[model samples]
Target: MDDILKLVEEYIKEKDSKKTWVAGEDWVQYAGPYFTHEEYVRAVKTLLNGWLVLGAEANKFETKFPPLLGKELGLFVNSGSSANLLMLLALTSKRGRNLPKGTKVITPVAGFPTTINPIFQIGFEPVFVDIELDTLNLDLDAVEKACQEHPDAKVITFAHVLGNPPNMDRLMEIVKKYDLILLEDCCDALGSTYDGKKLGSFGEMASCSFYPAHHITTGEGGFVAVKDEQTERIVRSFREWGRGCYCIGKQNLLEKGSCGTRFNCWIPSLPDHVFDHKYVYEEIGYNMKPIELQASLGLVQMEKLEEIGLKRRENYRSLFKAFSKYPEFFHLHTAQPKSDPDWFAFPVTIKDGAPFKRSDICQFFESKMIQTRPYFAGNIMLQPAYEGLHDKDEVISKFPIAHKVTTDTFFLGTSPVINKEKTDYIEYILDCFVAAIRI
Candidate 1:
């Protein structure tokens, strides 16, 4: 056992050492997983234990993660996309007043597909809102207008775009005025806060991603953080195949269930015989639970968040400073007045009258092997998948900002992997591109 442990330690060191960004050869990766030996070891240890499904690691991660973002509880899922779906589905469950079918949900059109997809998937209509070019978040006035125009709007779901938080002060006021439910997609906003409070904590429930590009990595894992136990149960119900049993972690058959009703319950809907609560299906659910290995890695990833988050912030600032002088050509990102963001990336948009086009600059970055990505499905409503589904009135593409994003916006990496050296290189290349275009 001692020799085996030594081998694992050695394997981690050798692999971790090779992960550095090697300037010219390696692409200044748009984003990559920030992980180390600790995460690797934990993942390996969990896999070796052979408890492949949800178990101790998942339990610890779920419990430990929520507090960092001020959430009281969390539910782990296979991916952030799945987390979004489950979060919305949970709201439409009993805990969320079982929002009636065809209820209107106000959300931005300029966001990841899953953030808006789940609304439609759960049979709710999304009243599209335009995003602000500066913050790349929902336009608050448009949101209020949508709410007043459509008095039936019961839910507001949106992401903290590229880690830039919206005006939460006014957002919450609107929420209160309308008695609307809030679901934050914090996939890009982990470690970010508005008015000193964490982004995820402000909403009824928030979803986070641990995909390679996010603030942290658990390979392909995500979690839904809830404000209370009832919401947590609703999220878990959807994640754990609609089962009503609440026993988390590794369960021992000999031990009584967490609720102490494992075998003692009588289901009114079931035939007159007593049934184990574990086998009972409460809501139609899917198998969205993540494996224990990912959860084990997530525990280690959570610890490195602070250090990694600092680098991301630094990278964003450096990029912003570099581009500030070129505002006419580029409209760089801005955070809400009260937001102190732990940014996901350094987003930049080519101004309408820029000498060159968005493609021109992005191609230049690609040629240099420094990766750039278009803002996640800019104007997602225009994407092929959403083509015929949205009616002319259902989506508000009339506001040109979202459509402009589709043509003008793109982002560069601000992940921990982007250090001073890479950021300098990015600036140097941007300078060259602009210089070339000027001639």
Candidate 2:
């Protein structure tokens, strides 16, 4: 087994060595996973261990992940979408100070569906607010206005767009003034910080993605991290099928149990003095737990978090410099002075009177095999699925910026996979395309 494992590791390394980032006709992916040979080996080892469910690897990843984002606890889930759902559901748990049904949640109009879907899924009214064109984040001024109009709003949930931190100073003020529960979707802003503190750490709870296109890859995985023990327990309950059991893995330990109630816990509704904790259902939840294999891969990917962040920042800067020369034709994504963003992609918005449209440039890029994608579901409210989900009165502010985003904004590859050759190709294509438009 040892010899075979060594050979497998060597094979992975050889395969990795053959990969390169030279510019060519092949597709330049908008996003791709960065995995070292070690990650492959760890995955194989976990597979051999046969603990396929959310076991030791999941526990270790959950335990070690919180500190990276300056949080107290982590709950692994199948995807970032599930993490978002779990986080929202936890806040509505019967065990916690549940926000009453139909409570208003303040969210941005321009964002991915999952960010706001969970609010509606969990029976909360979503009050949409506009985004700032420059930062591609919630315009806090608009957010404050919406909050004032809807004084009953009880929660604020939003994403750090393309890993660019929002105006944390003003956002925190609004959060405090309204006394709202804050949940940051840190899926894109994994390593981003506002005022020197991590974005995820600022919110009461946060969600992170481990998808291939995100900062890290576990094939398909994510986590919901919290700052308090009780919240952690609630999140854990939701991720693990709403079980009352707080045991790490199972309730088979000889000593007191993981939660100190292994064999001793009374149920008010039950006739039994001490029912098994594993079977206790505390709240309505779902089976969203991730497997050990995904956790094993995530553990290895976690080791490169800082390195990936640095590379992403480097790529973003180079892309920014390249695009800055075309300010008249583009609206480049911006970061506040207090923000330290590890950008996920280099977003470009065609100016209102630009000779070309987003489709024009994106089509040209696609023809050259340089991938581009629209901002994820720009103006999610405009999406067909939302036809009847919201009331007309729920929109307190106009989504002019969001409407512009849907038509003007698109993003290019700034992933670590983009090397100098690819960047040069990108710049060359942009120059040619712009010159053509000028003609």
TM-scores for the candidates: 0.96, 0.96
Candidate 2's displacement at residue 368, Å, is: 0.4
Model 1 ranges with Cα > 4 A deviation: 18-22, 391-397
Total residue pair clashes for candidate 1: 0
Best by lDDT: 1
TM-score (C-alpha) between model 1 and the true structure: 0.96
Ten-residue stretch with the least lDDT total in model 1: 390-399
**lDDT of model 2 at position 272:** 60
Per residue, candidate 1 scores C-alpha lDDT tens digits across 171-195 of 9999999989999999999999899
Give the per-residue lDDT digits (tens) of candidate 2, residues 1-439: 5776798799988988897654655778878889777888888888887778888888889999986666978888999999899888987877786887898999999889999999889899988889989988988998899889999998899999998978888899999998988999999888888888987998889999988999988999888989878888888778777887787765445476676765655578665677777777787768898889998898998889899998888888887888888999988988887999889999999988888889999999889889999999998987888877565345423688888898899998778877767877888888888889888
Residue pairs in collision within model 2: none
